[model samples]
Target: MRWSHAALNCGDLDTTEKFYTTWFGARRVNEFDLGDLRIVFLRLGDAYLELFGQARPPAGETPGGDGHPVAGTVRHIAFQTDDLDGFLRRIEGQAEITLGPLDFSAHIHGWRSVWLRDPDGVIVEVSEGYRDRA
Candidate 1:
């Protein structure tokens, strides 16, 4: 099966939505509001993004603390780009580059990647010359 969307919990839905739409070119496809909760779906190329937010904690579970990036999970959600240099220029002074613009040519010929941290603390990888294999 092909990969789909990555869902994230947003403390502020509007900010999260704007971050993706502005920086990564994701567009809103659908949205829902259930009183204390909100969900927005966005599409980027063939992939989708699902964002959910809650006004308060549920009955038993505690709130996620400190707004820090979680580690040892998922690693990252990657996007392939045709122009890694041009993409880097576009995000300059606007988004935070957490890592890379480094070479991965050791693994794949002509491959390079850069990682950015989204507003919701998700690591997004933008790469060139990488593709799914059969």
Candidate 2:
């Protein structure tokens, strides 16, 4: 089976949608409003990312805190790019680079990766040269 979309809880739907669209070239595919919550789906090629926003978040749960550095149910989300250098250049001063543009040549062939945080502190990993052994 192929992979599908990943969903995220966003504090601000507009900001989160803009972030994905501007940096990853994602386009809006669908949206839903359910009185107290809003959902938006964005497409990047076949893959999709879902954004969920709530008007009133449940107690003890902080909105837009999904990308915390600490370990949790989901630590981070990753994306692969063909032009790593160009992508980095595009995001300059726009997004926060939390970790490397490090080489993983020895461990994983020619893979190179960098990590960053989204608007809500969610860690995102971008890499290149990953060989899918499917």
**In lDDT terms, which candidate is top?**
2
- Top model number, TM-score: 2
What does candidate 2's lDDT look like per residue over 1-134, in tens digits?
88889998887888989999999999999999998889999999889999998534434532232244445657679889999999999999998887788898887788998888877656888999988665
Off by over 4 Å in 1: 55-72, 132-134
Each candidate: RMSD: 5.2, 3.7
**Tens-digit lDDT track for model 1 on 19-96?**
888877899999998887899999998899999985342244221222225465566777888999999998898767
Clashing pairs in 1: none
Worst 10 residues of 1 by lDDT: 58-67
